[model samples]
Target: MNLRLYDTAARSVRDFEPLQPGRASIYLCGATVQAPPHVGHIRSGLAFDILRRWLQASGYDVTFVRNVTDIDDKILQRGTDEGIPFWQVAMRNERAFTWAYDQLGCLPPTYEPRATGHVPEMVELMQRLIDAGHAYPADGDVYFDVRSLPEYGALSGQRLDDMQPAADSDAQIKRDPRDFALWKSAKPGEPQWHTPWGPGRPGWHLECSAMASRYLGPAFDIHGGGMDLLFPHHENEIAQSKAAGDSFAQYWMHNAWVTTSGEKMSKSLGNSLLVSEVVQRVRPVELRYYLGSAHYRSMLEFSDEAMSEAAAGYRRIEGFVRRAEESLGMPESVPVPDAFAAAMNDDLGVPQALAVVHDTVRVGNAALAADELVGAREARDEVVAMLDVLGLNPYAPPWAAQSDDGAARRALGPLVDVVLAQRAAARDRKDFAVADALRDGLAASGIVVEDTPAGPRWSLAEEI
Candidate 1:
């Protein structure tokens, strides 16, 4: 498969060629662990997850590294506010992020190295830049000298002269105002580690550069994060990594933001929809579908109406798979359609790929209506395969029995059986009125009961 991706650094879509013959490496900027992940944050993970799935589907060994910024200014502040240790605050939010990722069916990363856990790697990276004359230690703080690197703004496409001063750290002793902190000086109440320069925590950008190099090697294939990180975060990463004489990421991929009311969804905006909160409104699978329905590069506008529409859309695909499985056998190992593959290869065009899935669902439903079980099974197979690639397969584990709605169905099964048994006794006693009442009650509760040769089977009533 000739995979293509839009490199944020190049500002153009290009064919993706892995550095290794049959292996691909990806470094996704993971959570900072200051708070539970909102949908806006998890969207980046979902986008990269789809990309990883596609690469694996296309027959490449993928090594994915998604790191956690467990030590940050915000994390320290949160701990101070809560009157707890910084690691405790970080660990609490980190578990929340892990839960959200798993709830959305994202495959776990190959290695999820925490920022605090890799202080040595971060120190080594800072030392390399300092030795290369691109960084310096001042007043117990290490800063990356931005002007020392001629290609500082290459990734973000802004010339160094046109850039604003780096506001990430104090500029008092910097050689240039654009210089950013590599390691911050320790504050009284914050976490700290010993380094040659001084005792301090790694800067946000420095952690990613160090962790990515440690796991994906000196050079990797793709580095990804949200569009908001395009500035100082990723820009500084490029400058320090390349200035240290190591080739960093081959391609830079960034996902667009999840917006609300024409504004970026952020905690400060008071419109942050946590994944845990959104999943309460919709099933985790439905939420994932809503999040992944749009193009990764497109801004996903979050609205209840849009989310409901996406949920309804997924139910259509899911309804077809469930119904088709009953008439035929369980869907497994079907050939993915050429159209779906083409769409995915074209920069992970999920919207187009999902269109192919819905079209196939239409075909499958039509075949089932016509009593063409063979054709229905074939269509179901293809649909299931496509959904599996997108990590939205309803029949798959975690989404299968673990879904809350599915669990409810399991819990209510015995009660429904009792009702059916009562109705059977009413029928035996020639009480048609009572029998009809039980049936009506079931129907009113959205349960449809059918007496088969085996026994009474029940299903949820189809929505109009």
Candidate 2:
């Protein structure tokens, strides 16, 4: 394969060579599900999902591991706020993240491990680091002695002297202020696991290193996460993992963030638009297109106007696909256009690839207009092939389910009409309470009723 990926570590687009021929291993730092996902949170998943699909299309057997940090300080805090257990908070938010991923049409990872489930692996890893004299325990907490790893900042291109102290735990016990925690000693009312050093919880950086090594082995082909993690999170992972004598990830990839109004879209910023809410305004597939249309490395600025334009673009493609299918039957799977492949090969350049999709759609529409089946079919097949690689194929499983929903909506219309008629009669009889009750019942059932000038109009509520 001639695919080239921009290695964040190397800071260049390099040819992708699997560790073992025909097999690729990836460990992506997944959700730290303390809260429900926003568009910013799922963009990384969508970006990597496209990469995984492309690798499969390129004939590589891929083992993808996306770990969930089910134990975290934020999770515990959220639990405290809600008067629930930390695990409950984690599980609830994790489900929300999963629903968002599925609604956006992301494929499931090969294995989605939780940090809490791999305490044994983390213990073993800590032992390895301790034995290597790269880590030490003090005051019931363990810290990775950053000085021990001479190549500590290679991945993130930072100098050890200029780095800030890792405030993950108490600084007084650490030999160096920069020495980050491998494990934090238990506090009152917080969950704890037994470790050789003491009873405590795994550090954020440590959990990912442990999970990745456990699933993909000590060393793997690629490690990916959002760009914000480059500093302390990813750099610390490199320091401890390599200090323990594992070669660790061969390549690093980081997707840029989604921003709104020149600020990063984050809950702390109070500017995050929830995925569940956004999908109500547009189809889930349209949201996917908007998120996935940009180059993975480029920052995507979020706005309603931009989203509307993206939805229109996706609708054009969908309209062409539906029309082509009606005339030529289902398009046979074929190789994507060379232009599309070349764009994808060059660092997963999706924007250029999407231009190709739009170009093909235009040609297909023209062919359909001229009553040319052969040309239309060729264009249709090429478009399907490209969309399939990008996980935007409309006729595929999850998106195809929308057709069934359309039929259900059609069936629901008459039933809702009958109720509205009864509601109208109640209103005409001067029984305001009965009419109000009927309207409220329909609203509770996700049917919105509007008393328009033409009469009563009903529609189903928007679904995430």
Candidate 3:
């Protein structure tokens, strides 16, 4: 099946064809780093991660670039509010976002460029826009001449006359109220960079256009961010990049927001749940499953009930995988089921894909119940392969053997060994009934034993 994705610019699902055959490039707008990210913030990361994995699985050499807006208005404000340097605030929160992404098993990007580090590129882009008569420098500030580009509002489908003022800078300094800033003049106690326009930092939109072009070239396969960015943020990026004579992104993909009470979750709303807080309530893998369980274009309503339910669902899948591994002496790789592949191919329909995973788990459980080890192994391997694509594989690194879980398993292993010795001694003395009872009791307590060529190995019947 073809990978058909919902391109926001096209406003419809279209088959994904890379600009370069066997190669895919993606630029995802990452954190601004004013504060630690909430689950809502990480949802986009997980969604795009699945997309990257799917592309690689389908034989594409993927170049994924996620950028950090380290020096922004919000970060500067945060620093003033906390009596710290803006750079300090940016670093603290950027590390938090990185930890959250890694905890959820999202693959690291090929290049995670910081906006501040690419000022030279931003300066080049601004110069190009100015040279093309699409931008102007005034009073130590540079503004994109929105009126010069007829396609200024094409990305967000808004006409310049009908739109609100750009509000990115002082209206008196701009050629047109709709013209957003390409650079902002430095203020007292704020970071500054020297550019032809004046001594100032790069504008928010200007940073992405420059960074994307620098790393991914003049054009890339996909540009992605949360749906909220579709307005002025992405709109301005398109205007400046296209006006500067770059092909820019071939496809625009936006992930829907995670909302609470039908409102977008935000720090201002006082409804945002931090990633660190939520992970304390559920395992990281389960949190990932919950976040990625919905279609990328669909809103995920935040709630404890919904999150708990998702956790339980993942536990069921994890339980089956653990059991199957004990009986089969470790699962080998298996092809994902056609139904699972089809679901993923259809715009990364993770809900449908998860339904397929659970169904396979049920089949594997039934096979195990009937002592059909071969059938069980087949179902387990397929489920694992599918999970691998979704980044939910319980046995994979990062998610595998977490500190507390590993400690618990390591402590339990010795106790189980003692019980196995008792059972073995009972069988050696020909006390078959006592040995059977001990084995049955252990099984009742969620421990499964398998006699292998090496020895009798044991594992938790239910995943930890």
* Candidate number achieving the greatest TM-score relative to the actual structure: 1
**Candidate 3 lDDT, tens digit per residue, 21-92?**
999999999998988999999999999999999998888999999999999888899889999999999999
Candidate 3 deviant stretches above 4 angstroms: 166-169, 403-407, 416-464
lDDT of 1 by residue, 114-199 (tens): 98888998898888888888999999999888888878888888998886655745667888887888899898866789889778
Residue-level lDDT of model 2, residues 1-464, one tens digit each, is: 38999999999999999899998999999999899999998999999999999999989999999999998889989998999999999999999999999999999999999999999988898899999999999988888998898888888899889877555446777888888888989999889998778899988899889888888988899999999999889999988789877889999999999999988999898899999999889889989999999898999999989998998898889878976887799889899999999999999999999999999999999999888999999999999999999999998868889644687678998898888888999999999999999999999998888785458766665442
Q: List the residue pairs that clash in candidate 3.
A: none
Question: lDDT value for candidate 3?
Answer: 0.89
| Weakest ten-residue segment in model 2 by summed lDDT | 455-464
TM-scores, all models, native as reference = 0.92, 0.88, 0.90
Local error of candidate 3 at residue 159 (angstroms) = 1.3
Q: TM-score of predicted model 1? A: 0.92
Question: 1 or 2: which has the higher TM-score?
Answer: 1
Best by lDDT: 2
